[model samples]
Target: MQVTFETPDQPDVHALIAELDAYLYSLYPPENVYALDIASLLAPNVEFAVARDAGGSAIGCAAVVVTPEYGEIKRMYVRPTARGQGLARKLISALEEKARAQGCSVFMLETGPTMQEALALYERMGYKHRGAFGDYPEDPLSVFMQKVVA
Candidate 1:
């Protein structure tokens, strides 16, 4: 498997984002979901990466939205068939590397409490619980986390 930076407009990436959106929508209410749309992923400050299998099928994706203070992770997802193989962890590591190259010293992300697996992964990766950042406000349904990039 390989992870590479890409725009969200690619057909496979677009389809993967659609699947991610559907999955998130199913897990959280509209107000609690904060996923970035394709246009947002194309923003100048955001870098998106996709993990592809040997055949070049996108199996997972993640993004880092760079700001003055930190890089915010967004739209992280791994296809169900691709789970349990550390693709999510690989995606996060790739995003962190991208963010570090951009001079970001910190990384943050917002996820829902219902996503226990995600929470566990973040914590294991050294992200600590934090209050909301960026445009996010305090919400019971949102769990915020951050890690200092070494």
Candidate 2:
């Protein structure tokens, strides 16, 4: 497996994003969802990462949207067949390294309450629970988390 920074417009990456979007929408109402779209992922402030298998098929993806103050993780997802291989962890590590390179002091994210595995992963990765940041308002369904990028 390999991970690299790339534009989110690639066909495989688009398909994966669609799948992720569907899954998240199913888990949470539209007002409660906070995922970045392809255009948003391609914006100047955001950096997208794609993980590909040996065959070069896009198997997972994540993005970091950097601002002057901090970086926010977005659109993190692994193909169902690709889970349990540490791809999510690897993708996040890559994002954190990129954020550090860009001088971002903190890394943050918001996941849904139903995503227990994701919450556990974020906790294991040193992200602590926090209040909503950026444009997100306080919502009962949102689980906000953050970690210093030191």
Q: How many residue pairs clash in each candidate?
A: 0, 0
lDDT of 2: 0.93
Task: List candidate 1 segments past 4 Å from native.
Answer: none
- Count residue pairs with overlapping backbones in model 2: 0
- TM-score per prediction, in order, is 0.97, 0.98
lDDT of 1: 0.94
Question: Over 4 Å off in model 2, which ranges?
Answer: none
Q: Which candidate has the top score in TM-score? A: 2
Q: Write the per-residue lDDT of candidate 2 for residues 1-150, one digit (tens) a residue.
A: 999999999999999999999999999899888888888898998989999999999999999999998999999999999999999999999999988898997999999989999999999999999998988899989999999955
**Predicted structure 1, TM vs. truth:** 0.97
lDDT of 1 by residue, 51-92 (tens): 999999998999999999999999999999999999999999
